[model samples]
Target: MRRLLILFAAAVAAPVLAADPAPEIRRAPVPPQALGVAHTLRTIPEACARLQGEFSGDAAAPYRFAVVRTSPGCRPRARLVDAAQARPSPASGWILNDLIRVPSAACATQQAVVRVWRQPAQVAPPALDPQGRARVYLEDSLQQARAGRLAPLPAYAVSLQVEGLPCPR
Candidate 1:
């Protein structure tokens, strides 16, 4: 009886301890569809700050990134990119590339368009303020291209842009 009870408790606790912790939500990526933009999308400090405020006190808590298109006559669309994919260089703090699909439907089999966005100015905020507030600033630029031209897409790699913050808190 003792052995069986110990085995059951061990089994129950194993999964709980072994599970991977949720990722820290340092940056949010909003699709252009929501903001109505076909060309330009800027992830400025003010917008990101406002979006982060909605989350709980925990900075690690995951929250969706809110984005808005600044171009005229452009409809809002969503562009999602993970922080891990962002590449950093001396010239730029973080860089992201996105493949813009030609069709809105998931089932549509059409040639995909590629777009690249990068923050020219990447700067980290000063000291952690009294309210535990930290700031990260980034600028976005978009250009169109194609994926089928360069290299075959990776199996696990789907259509996602790059997102990053150099000095992530």
Candidate 2:
């Protein structure tokens, strides 16, 4: 009697305690089909401030990066990359060597295109303010990548090729 009640309560509480907590994701999501190539050349301080604004109060949030074509005339497409794949650009203060794959409906093959985006100025992320925070976020990203937990920040990875997801109205 009492033993059965205790067992039931323990069973109910076990899952609640063992389950992983929900990730803190941001609300302002980038448009799935972003309009154009990102040509903004911002200095580090400016970039840090914008990045802070982009992630709101949480500076550790994963940012939404896009690899759009430099030229216009085609339907704009943007694909999100995980922190694991976003290699820091040595030439510029940005992510580079990111592999962007354009999904081909009829085939399963993937091709890698190499491209680097260079901003016009030498402005760096702020030294002690948001810059420090950005550095911390990137470092955390590196740690998370090692642990295979990289995609939970900005939003769970979205695949345009998923069969059952409904189209946005």
Candidate 3:
């Protein structure tokens, strides 16, 4: 009876275990808007400032920013930015790209700056939602606004190594 029960249990679990997991469903892209233009600035900080001003730095709903950096301490460049609160979980936070690892052995440098005339589509801005779901209208609007010529403006930012600052290598 025990051997029969074991066989039965194995048979039941075999189908369940062999079944594939459901694929994650992401939102589809929206259609393009008319050929338009968005005024451009020259740095990620400028982009952050623009959003902050628009949001009026509201305490309850403050504009969030993800500061991206590049290094080697030898070469510096504006990598990418995501407008969302940096969360611990992958599904609910600033999804980071590859880090600009600067080896101290070859490059022992200081002070860096990164800027860009416009944010690219591939590295588009993040339309954050506290609930961590698809933000259709917000993402769509940003996408539309950025899909055009950008008139460059003079705006930039700087970074440095500060003593006593907690950093994760």
C-alpha TM-score for every candidate: 0.19, 0.18, 0.17
The digit string of per-residue lDDT tens for model 2 on 1-169 reads 5466445645754574354232232123222222232322112221121111111111232123333333344432233344345543443344332222221122112111122222233334533654555444678768969999644222112111111111122
Residue 67, candidate 2: Cα error in Å is 12
- Which candidate leads the pack in TM-score? 1
Question: Pairing residues by index, what is the TM-score of model 1?
Answer: 0.19
Off by over 4 Å in 1: 1-94, 103-112, 128-169
Residue range 3-111, candidate 1, lDDT tens digits: 6644564565457435423322223543323212233323333112111111121234312234343445543233333334744222443333332322212111111
Q: Give the winner by lDDT: 2 or 3.
A: 2
Worst 10 residues of 1 by lDDT: 46-55
Supply candidate 2's per-residue lDDT for 129: 55
Give candidate 3's whole-model lDDT: 0.29
Per-residue alpha-carbon lDDT of candidate 3 for residues 13-56, written as tens digits (9 for 90 to 100): 45743542332222232222111222111224323432111111
Q: Tell how far residue 3 is off in model 1, in angstroms.
A: 64
For residue 80, model 1's alpha carbon misses the true position, in angstroms, by: 16
lDDT of each: 0.30, 0.30, 0.29
Better of 1 and 3 by TM-score: 1
